[model samples]
Target: MSRQKMLARALIVFALLGACGTGARLAAAGEFVAEARTIAELKAVFGQVESRTVVPARARIGGTIREIGISEGREVKEGEVIARVVDDKLTFELNAADAKIAALQSQLDNARTEFDRAQQLLARGIASQSRLDQAKTQFDVIVSQVAAAQADKAVIEQRTREGAILAPATGRVLTVPVTLGSVVLAGEEIARIASGQYYLRLSLPERHATEIKEGGTVLIGQRGLSPVASGGSAAARQARIAKVYPEIADGRVIADVEVADIGDYFVNERTLVWIPVGERKVIAIPPAAVTTRHGVDYVRVATPDGPLDVAVVLGETFQDGGGPRLEILTGLRPGDRIVMPDVAP
Candidate 1:
């Protein structure tokens, strides 16, 4: 054959291969059928981190605070001494009790000597029996007086020991209201502590009160002024609704959520939380299959005629075991096939 004829035959073969490639690419495109999928409808609301129990360490004795050992943000153990209070009057009373006891002891010794002399004198027939009896009574009276004084001193000592204020619970100290040298009365709070496990407190509208139930799950958003889920791991954002209060207040219903490792969170710190209020059937698909053009979203649908681009109203993004999914609010019907963009060659 001539060289020109051979080149023409090669060009024809290349055209035939290109046509076959086009058909193969079209056949390889993936398709997804739209269906009604039941999803939990989540309502986003602010949740405030709070401690389960707030306990106050109070002064047991009225006095001036002599020393303070704790401040705000400090962790404390139960029965730990946090402050010390000392009353000067108590010390003086203790001293007075000791003096009274010493005086009675002296008197008791003198009475014993007198009683011994009286008994000896009576045995010798020099002292009367009535006199000996009177001396013995005086010795017994002095002994009772000494015992009473000693007991009074013991009570004063106990009061002095009570001047030390101890923490009522094991937790972090939230506030220290009293300072060293500050005068405080008995039972006055020296410090306020946040105790027990920390949780999120949510207040929702009364209209959704019936939907909120114990043991339900909620999604935690990133910590910030506006709490929006930021594609975080499922384990980090998952939490359980631990409690729901029966009483509604101020047109709102209250609930508690428990999360693992919220111990470091500040009390009363607000964060975004998504609660499942109800379930509804909706069309959802992966975001990769949808394309955005000029502020509108579009998805390709495989029709009997050919592939067609259909307009879709997009809802919120949610997570499932497969990955992040975009909600289709409109323009998609059940049994309609969707063309996957990534699967195309």
Candidate 2:
């Protein structure tokens, strides 16, 4: 064949292949469907809830527990006498000091009388100078004895007051470690009390803790509690981040959150808490629609004729609700149709 004819045949084959590719692309377009992006009020991603154990109150003095004023699970006020120590030795010492004080008072009275008599005798020249001096000295000695006795009595009284055990603060009694009439040593734990005001102490990953601040809000939920199955009603309680502990515990930052007036509801010894960060209202789509290609996040949006890949600015996830949806910060709107597999938008 001639060279011009051969070139003509090659050009015709290329044209046919191009037309076939166009037809295939057009057919794929017909299978795509549009999906409407709904605008629903979504909750922001809040942190997790935490709890700690309540410690018991200990006794300040050692003796037989004479009384137990509070029962388990009962509320107690500050400075309330939770127990009493029967220190018979302390009581005997107190009685002895009182007797000595009375004796010293009588002696002081006698000394003053003697001093008055000696002064009268000297003025009348009926007593010698040596006798008057001796009388005065005796009076002074008795006065000193009375002062010492009074000081001893005061010390005994103070110790007597300390024998009564008082409540450290207002809280609910959890356990009675000592029974009535049981011998207790000084500084021994007599009872455990849970402070009515509860705080959540927990440790979080170092990276997550950086996003938290003192006085921020925290959400609490029971551990092993699933939000999707229960609709997150139990996880709705709010808490204030009271403090962030300075040191890291278990490789995580320790934080304390104060539950807002919900202490009464949480009667259990242990519970969980959650803390939330930044949140807003935005368009959300299922995670399945999100596709990652070459380290970039893309979602297929339903177009009139077919699905088109659109780049999305992603926000926090709302995983608590039934549907696991990603908040769309940008690139989507309400009422925009989205196509599911095998359907046209």
Candidate 3:
């Protein structure tokens, strides 16, 4: 088929779409009354897929990364160990602490034996009171020394436990900056996780900022750079405005649209989105009432003289609960009756 024939057929199919309820065309009467109805004026804008919260898994102690259990795009749970860091010095220090504790424990044993013997002698009137007191002091000092060594060992053990890098949030890992054998310092990031729910981040023009609010409804267009149809099945997704940032930067207002099932979307991925800036009254008619000829759109009107075809300039098509309705920009007025053509046999 020729391009013109294809175009004509496509327009015919588009014209057959009719809204329901009050906006529905009176097919039996073969006429539709044009009236002004309030509709949301949508502004087409680009939105980026983003996570609500991005948390980074960080190392608590300085060490060389010994192993990494996660990579980019891997899912992780909160407090999950994603990597392990090893500090050879910490192991050595722990060993030294243990050895010191052992030595002090031996000394404590000897001091304890001496204190007991001194106490026994004192009780038998063989040792002076001062001698027993000195032995007791030595034993107590050795015991304290052992306890200090054990405390040092505990500190080392805690540092060793910090070597494991745990994920901060339960979500997909976005980036892993450090690899195996990479030397990292304490408080350094190991991996960045995209956590919580994903949403679309819209940077709309500052002019529409006042019109947007939390809990407002918006439409999602096609993914990527594909041109969005005026309003069609593919662009029928409706989302709620989760938040609107107060600050404006570079004449743009940032807002977040909460969309479920966007978790599979890549972070920073761009998609077209339609935001309702405000409401306006427009004359909408069903597609079945309009006809196209020679690349021009025409609608028949039932005038007092007879039915006459009037050329109409059409705007964006809007999808609502009724159906898809085409907005007539011009060539028609409110209270005008349109003649609906008979269905072809």
Candidate 4:
């Protein structure tokens, strides 16, 4: 071969080797990359909004409701009269008792006169001792009967006063089960009154009960209301866990959360409550970097050995003005290289 041909062949070989080296360098530089953040974390317990109903306070005595002092939805103080019962029989009994007392007084006056006369006759020896004793016994018996009648009258008056149903506590009237002039039976519910102090009862999964403690702080949010951003802009009421019901029902443990600042809203069984477990600071990454497969969560991290697969335990999601990020519970640390979606994996 000629020297010029040999030199051209050597040049072509060098060119091919240079191209292969460049391709390998590019391939080595290309790996998945992700931007991560360390975020302040908080745990929020979510609950549903609910309206509560007031229970009826029953009347102790049966009578016709002649007067209703308050209407439905009226706020009443303790011991305020809500309704009055019209009981003519009680009134008549009282009147008859008074008449009987007056009649007894006249008969006692006559008996006193006869007893005095009998005493005089016995002293003058014109009447026997037995006659004097008889007059005395008659007077004592009449006085006793009069006292009994008066006692019966007093009882009737007391019962008549009790026939007027009064508000047992300070609360708002939720319902009027009986109308004016309606006859209510004894111990019948006249109206339902709701106390201003409200309590939030929550049924949580039984497993969560182990983590909950009495007096723990609880955040109550109306369910259906828009989720609040992670800042202080949202309105959330706070409450304390007053008690934990010892029994479990329907696979949930019952807990009572007390909220003293009860507004003019009705609460029912559907109310939701959010209990705070605790707070911690953790490393966070974009949700896109994390992927789930076969019910296990994984993330690709850049390492000396190329893209490395990491299994991570996830914490709460933090959403702020800058958007949302996922908190990493484990298997991740600060300064770890995480894959960003735009980078080729």
Candidate 5:
């Protein structure tokens, strides 16, 4: 098929997704359930998923990238060699340094012999003391030169050994900025990696700067562990605001929200976050009263006349003396008793 036909078919397929009627069901009498309580109002906002620890792999010296052993999105171990830097020039310099040391050592040996001979002659009164002093100074200078040459060679060898870039921490590679034969400067970043743990990065409007505080509650809709629900991991978990930035940027205040099951999310994934800036009254019911069918949530209300089966939009689940309860977003009202699904009319 032609490209245009394929594109048109794809659009049509997408347009046909989730084709269903959204209507509530009616049921008879059931067990009595609790009511929703008005709690802190959560303000929904957009946020990004990011790793808590970002590790950057850098080059120790200015050289061309000889080889890259890892690719983007690959997991790496701590201290594992991921890339090599070409340092042929340093290798040649190191060889020269060794040769210089060898030459200096030979010169020092000859100087020592001459100094011994001058000392013997001066002791036998056949040579002046000044001659012995000159020979001693010459021997000492040659020794110092050999020591300096050896020290320089050691430095070169150390740098040459450091040509291999190792991962500082175990993590999934985010990006390999440099490829084979890419010339990178000393201390330049060659790769970026994420160190496992992830969090929600929220950018709240600066108007709520004062309202945003550490330890405040947030509702996160994403993969992994839920911050609020106990035990089972829910897509929408209650999380707490881990940090609130002191400074505002571009009319926004940024904050970090810590959540569990960070391993389930990839870095930089976009998600919706809801933060409770203040509290209000809300209707809630016990979790037992809510039922799911075909992925839609519903609840039953108990009226004095009979058990009214009302379709309810489920909200945040909270706990009081009555244990875990679900927030009724719609289709219910205050003072309406709810019935558990297992209860009979």
Candidate 6:
């Protein structure tokens, strides 16, 4: 064939391919739509799920640890004994005090007897007044010594019982820092526990500091969770912003979201948290019609020429009765018709 003829054939093939490409886009017109809706306002953020209350079990009296009653990850009830400290030293102190009291008691008895004798003799005009006064004074001094020894014994006895560290609250023991035979000081931490309830802690940009307040709703969920089959499980996921920290650190505002069934989550586990910041009109599109490719989100929009793949910036993905929906922050407008492509968006 002549060179001109060959060029003509190549042009015809190029035109055919363009025509077919247009046909595919035109066929997508039935699958998508652009509509103005009050999509639930939300901001998706990554956060750590942690126990809202963590209590430390500490040794109240200095002693060597004698027994550890619970292991890590063990559930303990409030007031349950977590460990025992050897009370041998405390026992020795109490015994010494008791011995001192016994020895002093004998002296006190002798003094009291002499005071009685002096009193009897004085009444009969046989004892000097100085002798009676000295006897009475000696008796009183001995009595005070005995009382002081008894008080010392009482404190040692109380400390002996307190050697057994008890759980501060119902919780799962997270760690046991002291082992059996380890000597510990008074007020030293022995174990750390996660108090039963938990919350999700997250940081938002400091710019949102003024907007976060207590009682604000936050949706919390882990990755790979499908829509729950039961309505009860769905309701359990609702979280509220229980506390908004007053101070900003590193350009972020801290907030705590309280949830009821957070015990299943491990401490510091990362999960998604969606806070409802504010609401406004948005072009909401169903997730089924949206396509993601190479880190970009796209949806097929039916243009005047034909269906076109338009890149969209999705704000926050929200769920409702229908299913997951995307909040289109850019690239679409109200009254624009769209469709799901036969292959993909």
Estimate the lDDT of model 4.
0.72
Model 2 lDDT per residue over 6-54, tens place: 9999999998787456434443542222233443232223333332445
Writing each residue's lDDT as its tens digit, candidate 1 over 163-246 gives 999999999999998778899999999999998789999999999998989998898876764533333323238899999999
Q: Which consecutive 10 residues in model 4 have the weakest lDDT in total?
A: 225-234
lDDT of 3 by residue, 131-234 (tens): 99999999999988998889989999999999988988799999999878999999999999998788899998888888999999888765655554434323
Q: Pairs clashing in candidate 3? A: 15-287, 15-288
TM-scores for every candidate against the unseen true structure:
0.86, 0.60, 0.83, 0.64, 0.72, 0.69
Candidate 6 regions off by >4 Å? 1-34, 38-43, 210-213, 223-237, 276-345
- For model 6 the local lDDT of residue 166 reads 95
In candidate 3, stretches whose alpha carbon ends up further than 4 angstroms from where it belongs are 1-29, 229-234, 303-307
lDDT per residue (tens digit) for residues 1-345 in model 4: 999999999999998887566444444553333335544323344443233445567777788898888877688887888888777788888989999999998989988998999999999999999999999998998989889988998899888988878888788887887788898888898888886466677777877767678988766655333354422213455678888888888888777787765455454534345565445567777777787878999877776865666899997665546566677888887787775544344
Model 5 scores worst on lDDT over the 10 consecutive residues at 18-27
TM-score of 2: 0.60
* lDDT, candidates in the order shown: 0.86, 0.67, 0.85, 0.72, 0.78, 0.80
Query: Which prediction has more favorable TM-score, 1 or 3?
Result: 1
Cα lDDT of candidate 6 equals 0.80
Cα lDDT of model 5 by residue, 200-304, tens digit: 899988778887889987777764334432222224577888998888889999999998775633778766777767777778777777777778777656566
**How do the residues 223-262 of candidate 6 rate in per-residue lDDT, one tens digit apiece?**
4233232221233267788999998999999998887766
Q: Judged by lDDT against the true structure, how good is candidate 5?
A: 0.78
- By summed lDDT, the worst window of 10 consecutive residues in model 3 runs over 18-27
Total clashes in model 3, counting residue pairs 3 or more apart in sequence or in different chains? 2
Q: What is every candidate's alpha-carbon RMSD to the true fold?
A: 6.4, 13.0, 7.4, 11.6, 11.9, 7.1
Error of 1 at 333 (Å): 2.0
Q: How are the candidates ranked when ordered by lDDT, highest leading?
A: 1, 3, 6, 5, 4, 2
Off by over 4 Å in 5: 1-36, 224-235, 282-345
